[model samples]
Target: MDCGPGDEGDGSSPVTTPTRTSSTPGRPSPPAEPSTAGRSSAAGRPFIAGQSSTAGRPFTEGQSSTAGRPSAPARLLASPAGVHAHARIAARADPHGRTVLPVLDGEGPLALRRTRATGPAAHVTLVGAMSGPLGGDSLAIDADVGAGARLSVGSAAATIALPGQDGAAARYDVRLTVADGAELRWLPEQLISVRGSALRVTTRADVAEGGRLVLREEQVLGRTGEEPGLLHSRLTVRYAGRTLLDQELTCGPGAPAGWDGPAVLAGHRAVGQLVVVRPEFAYESPESAVLGESAALTPLAGPAALITALAPDALRLRHILDDALSRLM
Candidate 1:
């Protein structure tokens, strides 16, 4: 079965969009409201002690800098723009049956580092070099596990998407391949969608016959007490050339009506899913059942199982997913 998801959007061009104030690490602070004591009001009459008539303008034309150099806003405008980056990882088994990482390449904002593994599997962690996946940025990560090898990949922190100068939608793509008899575990941190940002994510995994996979994905709608931006995600998994799962989800503006309604998110701020594929499932399939209030575990048509859950925050979501993973595995 090839159940591909529908297109989300082109996201090829930049369009001006409104952004909100944010204090996320690596995000720039919005320029302060400029003083408008001498400007004319809309009615051609200016009053008020410390207010500006220019409703939305950041600063007036004749405003002079504190020094000979440009103002802070000007300096911010000249800062480096978003980046296009790709990171790659390859794990192979040695003659002694130990997993080894022959390729761990990091680029731009997507820095890949080899970390200490708890078991035979080689571990790799993602480290962000700078703030990104901002609007207009394109990021991708490719990982491959050779036959008979075991590998695990994780991230150091949550990814925060912020609006860029161009206002374009940012994109992050992940591709994974596991050869026969190999195993892979992809456990990344949550992704937080800040207000006024737009992000699109695609994750595709191909597992050969006898290969095993454990993957997790989590999304946080927004920060504490704040409205979310736009977030679209698609997850596709193929086992031995057959599509096991292909799902798409969208939230915030432009999503399907009532996405956050009772039938969907139900006012939840965090959502996540876990997929586990192993050869053992072919003989003894797991039973479908609900795990608590907002989570379910069901066996797929093939030798695989899926666990989906929702929660009010990232902590609760992680706890739910973790509990489900323990039960399933």
Candidate 2:
């Protein structure tokens, strides 16, 4: 099977369409309201005065100090084709942060939602979403792609904020399970952590026999005019039970400063990862070389068929994807 752009439904840009399943229930039920007594302020004022109170400590009076913060959770909207796949997408605020409200809506051809703030360290999980950005109040995504499903995930835009100074560092954990003959394509937007911001991201995937998977992750530092920011990134990818890729990049004033060298980033402002895995199909020499040059691609030397690429721009990365898919076709 070609399994490329044209081979799929329409050739227009891909979008995520979420549908509910028993495995992935509807949006979380709204939390119960606090009692009248619990709504009073510490200064003896009524609940109205307590609405904007900041002097109280965290998690006091059955109300969290971090309530009503900004959080962007995952949403799986319906696709244009209306192909019903058993998919699940859910999120839980981290123990340290506040619980956020995850909005769920279907907009034409895409499903959309934002995570209302819980507190700091609130984390959301996507059991399943086709493709789009995952934003928290802190601005990041923690995603998982299950077995036997074709999932192509991405972000709405580039994230430039970080933790502490601006907020907590954005983090993502993507786990993929590709069953026999299943496929997954994850293409999230680039992540740009500002100078004072911090980020920690990781992705892992499990591929069964005859299964296929494709993944892309990009990280950038500094805005067009802002000074270069700090970035701490670690990526790990697993196939079956074996580790296929492990890399760590820490860029900051205090960290080592040799990334400009030829072996490292070579002063490129952006970096990315594109991976494709299949058991039967293989890349030809010409196609392999083209992919290698476009994204500085690399192939895993093992029983599994996996290709990885690192790029400096989204356009180039997309071009590489097109070429790779064309070759596969």
Candidate 3:
């Protein structure tokens, strides 16, 4: 909750919390011996990254690629392309059993770090070393879910979009791929579009047959007691070579946003949405359904639903989102 500039809240704990797990190759968990100091224990658990069915037994020390030394934390990067942060996680089926294994875990700014394991799911949180998306800033996340893997992911704090040093617009792009029979739940924190700031979130996901995906997106046009800024968002989802969702929203032209006029936000300060795609999803989404005046649930094509919550302040908006989620959760 106390997310500072360039720093994130402690999401590694609550110890049972949000985000999700990931994987990649590492030194196998070594046998107890003087030669294998600092080796992580594989005897604890084998999570595919998100949440897997109970069919496969968990992986043991004798069957792990990352049982040895742990992966390093993410670093900050800045280049001509812009200040960019990258995190990649890939999961695979363990040859030893029905369990899934993590083969890669990496990140830059808005770094993704895994905490402890819980059941068939791996916990992960995104932490930042500094304030970002200062116009032209790009954050790209790539996740791959093997044929039977599962993963959950979230951010430790809200993304504070600030004006760029050279007045360029900020960008955050996410790319997710869920293979056959895989699952991924991506629920990051709200994004704060501050006054004079320009921010955008471009997300693209590809889900293979029999896969499932749950994703949440929240945005705040302005912090408490401040004017709104500019926000642009895009979402694209496809499965089995069929496009399920393709949409975009733009608020204001540039720096000083037009929150009062005829924008979709309707002078509101906040908005939130959730999307779910499962193998069993067959209901036709309706155009829109109001939720007690605090929110509206829109059924999109396929097995996806979008909830939009609008309020004069952040608190009310969040409460509305929570109420809407409780029904679906």
- Top-lDDT candidate index: 1
Q: Model 3, 136: alpha-carbon shift in Å? A: 2.6
Off by over 4 Å in 2: 1-147, 166-170, 281-294, 303-317, 320-322
What does the lDDT read for residue 328 in candidate 2?
A: 49
- lDDT string, candidate 3, 180-259, tens digits: 88888888878888877788889998988788888788877877877756888898888876888887877755524554
Can you write out model 2's per-residue Cα lDDT over 1-329, one digit (the tens) per residue?
11121121112122222232332222221122222222222233111111222221111112122135321122122221112222222222323332222322222112222221132321211211221111222113333333343444443344443333223344444555655545556655566656665555556666666666677666665655454455666666665666767777876544576864677766666666666666644343223344565354456643333344445654565566656655543
TM-scores, all models, native as reference: 0.76, 0.53, 0.70
RMSD of each: 15.4, 16.7, 12.6
- Give the number of colliding residue pairs in candidate 3: 20
Lowest summed lDDT across 10 adjacent residues in model 3 is found at: 15-24
Clashing pairs in 1: none
lDDT values for all models: 0.72, 0.41, 0.59
Residue 21 shift from truth in candidate 1, angstroms: 20
**At residue 193, what lDDT does model 2 achieve?**
58
Over 1-329, each residue of candidate 1 has an lDDT whose tens digit, in order, gives 01101001111111111122232234532222223132222332121112222222122212111235343334333434445666678888888888776666555456555555568787766754444568877889999999999989887667788776667898999999999999999999899988888999999999999999999999999889888889999999999999999999999877889999988898999999999999999999999989899989999989999999999999999999999999888
Q: Decide which is better by TM-score, 1 or 2.
A: 1
